[model samples]
Target chain A: MVDPEIRVVTIDDLGILRSVQEDPATGRVVVTITPTYTGCPAMDVIRADIRRALVATGHPDAEVRTVHKPAWSTDWISDAGRAKLAAAGIAPPAPARRDGVVPLTLAVRCPRCGSPETEQISRFGSTACKALWRCRSCAEPFDHVKAL
Target chain B: MNGPFTFALALGDDSLIAAQRLAEWTTRAPEMEEDVALANIALDQLGAARLLLTYAGELEGAGRDEDALAYLRDDREFRNCLLVELPNGDFAVTMAKLLVLAAYQVPLYTALAVCPDERLAAIGAKARKESAYHLDHAMLWVKRLGDGTEESHRRMQAGVDQIWPYVDELFTTWPDAPVDPAVLRPGFDDTVTEVLTTATLTVPQVSWTPAGGRDGVHTEHLSYLLAEMQVLHRAHPGARW
Candidate 1:
């Protein structure tokens, strides 16, 4: 299913869908999902969507579990998903260094014009997962999925 | 007091109270971007607080949930450090507070990530990633405002001085806590000093450090914050949207 917030990508594409398994004890379909951010309001909606999908697929006895062990990261977003995000006018993130250093500001290219000249308008955007940026070449504003 | 219970409770309270304070800037931040940034950080704090408080309640085994522990308790019952409970006196003050708070949390949560406690480790590992972002954001602002204009520099220095005394309370040693606060002090000092130095702000050398927030003795400001935060929850008791 597409993310309830960003409809350009599916849950699998976004990497929030962690696993689908069958419980040994209860013999029920168990689906596990991870959240990109702890306070993401989309989680409840995603859970409800997963449940609805299961009901439609004849697995009314499904169990959806939320896990937080390894934490979610922007690195998990698939390449195809990144393309989709760009096509939708949202710039995808570069690989985030795991050492927690904030990268330099001048790297993000404009999604619309593919120009390397872009300035960050805000570190935060319309959604928690993205940042606001404006292209110098095309002069169009866009969103960039933040590299966590 | 149960050491683990108190430890978890204190950390959780820190996050909860800090989140509330940051969220107060939702529409009132000087700019729209800042409004979103502070709210985003606030959301991260709230998320960590939920995981922490839920675990704390389980450790206590007293039937209290995150909501009950967060909403039902009076200010006197809170175990948060005084730093978080203080008012957002100025924009610079808010940045100063965030810089200090995130500095402490990055090390604290990083240490906790590898600690022996399973649930705490998991939560720590997850939340630390977000804390790193908060630290970066705070550092950016602290430097920008602290080194900007003469007036901006003056206010930023004042903000740091106002908040510095509260900093000592956060690093009080709790050897029994999941990750002892003493161990995290060095990292905090390093981060804060580097930022303040680059920003051309003097690190305050205050002799009189007022504390006692961990034991629930907070400034009167906490009561007003709590009154607003808990009002809706207390009014409806089990309210849900």
Candidate 2:
């Protein structure tokens, strides 16, 4: 039995690879992915990568489809994902409000220096999903996953 | 309350209206990647509309949520530009339109991120990133198509030919419009021209441009799209998915 937690953490930490499904007919798998943001350049490569991984694991004919509905959110990261994120040296997304209103003090910490003393340089980073951050502790720049 | 909600409607209308047009190419794009790309862009636009409209409904406090406003409104009520509502003629044509509009919107959101209204600013913050990717995606295609084979170049030119007339409507300001175009990003035309030059495509020369979407006067295509989009919501009011 595959541990659901590991899958959760892997997806959460990587911030890609949205959902996986196994086909009962041929025992093949289909993975449903949503890009981190709408215009992610790596999405096509990621889709192909997912297909390759599934095929390498004996699901050669497995089909993968990308879905955009209900949209992916940073809030979907599970506890296991948070742990993986911490271990990966990246800070996890701050908790979300049930009321759907973002709190004012929800500043992201720099992963490299582990300092909350950072500022948002831009809403965009190296990739579409991350925001650029400059750490006060190390004064090094890094990307922080923006809250959805 | 009125200004914020109206501004939100302008944003929402832009996305919802654009998505409707992009959805027309769902199964008809040149290739699979193109299909997915178009659909993904459409979905992103739709999602943007949903977010903005939901916020607008909350601010209005009139018991009209996103669903009610999106589904129940007539064409005249929408505040989108005519450029978004124009039909997708061919791949190059669609890409040309995308290049123009996305070029306009990327800077528009970049500046809007600093808006005094926190919600608008926050939404703009998120949208700025999304629209950048969108603009890049479309711009990449514009370059590929423009510099490709002779047949490809012809189609690309033809695409521009068909879409050139509609471009002027995007920057026009209407006195009674929901969002003032003057308050939008300046030099929109210049930015579009720069993008065209970068793509190795010449900007089409046109004298007359169509404009009328803000007041709900849309081409006949819009009614058909609305009919298809709102059927489920209209038939079963208050339906949730």
Report the number of the highest-TM-score candidate: 1
Q: Counting only residues 3 or more apart in sequence or on different chains, how many pairs clash (N, Cα, C under 3 Å) in candidate 2?
A: 1
Interface RMSD for model 2 amounts to 9.8
| List of clashing residue pairs for candidate 2 | B76-B216
For all the predictions, what are the DockQ values? 0.71, 0.05
Best-performing candidate as measured by DockQ: 1
Predicted candidate 1 versus true structure: per-residue lDDT over B1-241, tens digit per residue: 7988888899999999999999999999999999999999999899999999999999999999999999999988999999998999889999999999999999888888889998899888888888988998999999998899999999999999999988888898887788999888888999999999999999999897888898999999999999999899999988798
lDDT of 2 at B228: 86
Interface RMSD, all models, one decimal each?
A: 1.3, 9.8
**Candidate 1 Cα deviation (angstroms), residue B60:** 1.4
Give the runs in model 2 whose Cα sits over 4 Å from its true position. Answer: A1-6, A10-148, B174-180, B183-187
Per-residue alpha-carbon lDDT of candidate 1 for residues A31-122, written as tens digits (9 for 90 to 100): 99999988787999999999999999989999999988787888999999999999999999988777655565649989999999999999
Interface root-mean-square deviation, candidate 1: 1.3
